[model samples]
Target: MKIDDWLLEILACPACKSPLRAESEELACTSCGLIYPVRDDIPVLLVDEARKPS
Candidate 1:
């Protein structure tokens, strides 16, 4: 499922409050290197749920 364009534009990274770029099924924060997964079209922005950069 795809997030709305406006919503995507407004969504920010919960960790560093940086803008997120849309990936295949996740939103990635370029600044902090956090990958937030989208579950059922809903973005899980919680820091605890984010994946760390390898």
Candidate 2:
């Protein structure tokens, strides 16, 4: 829930290269709307591991 601003600034959606915004325990894509999980404060950015946009 609390990712560093600098890190967040560099994170992008693997699907669409869109910016990611921290949401709960996941990162939501701004373009494709993919939801990537965050575990132990590390982001899981694999496209296959992302949740479908809802």
In the predicted model 2, the residue pairs found to clash are: none
Candidate 1 has a TM-score of 0.92
The sequence of per-residue lDDT tens digits that candidate 2 reaches over residues 1-54 is 668999999999988898999988999998888899999899999999999866
Candidate 2, which ten residues in sequence have the lowest lDDT sum? 45-54
List candidate 2 segments past 4 Å from native.
none
Query: For residues 1-54, could you state the per-residue lDDT of candidate 1 as single tens digits?
Result: 689899988999988999999999999997998999999999999999999977
In candidate 1, stretches whose alpha carbon ends up further than 4 angstroms from where it belongs are none
Q: Candidate 1: which pairs clash? A: none
Each prediction's whole-model lDDT (CA): 0.92, 0.92
TM-score of each: 0.92, 0.91
Error of 1 at 34 (Å): 0.2
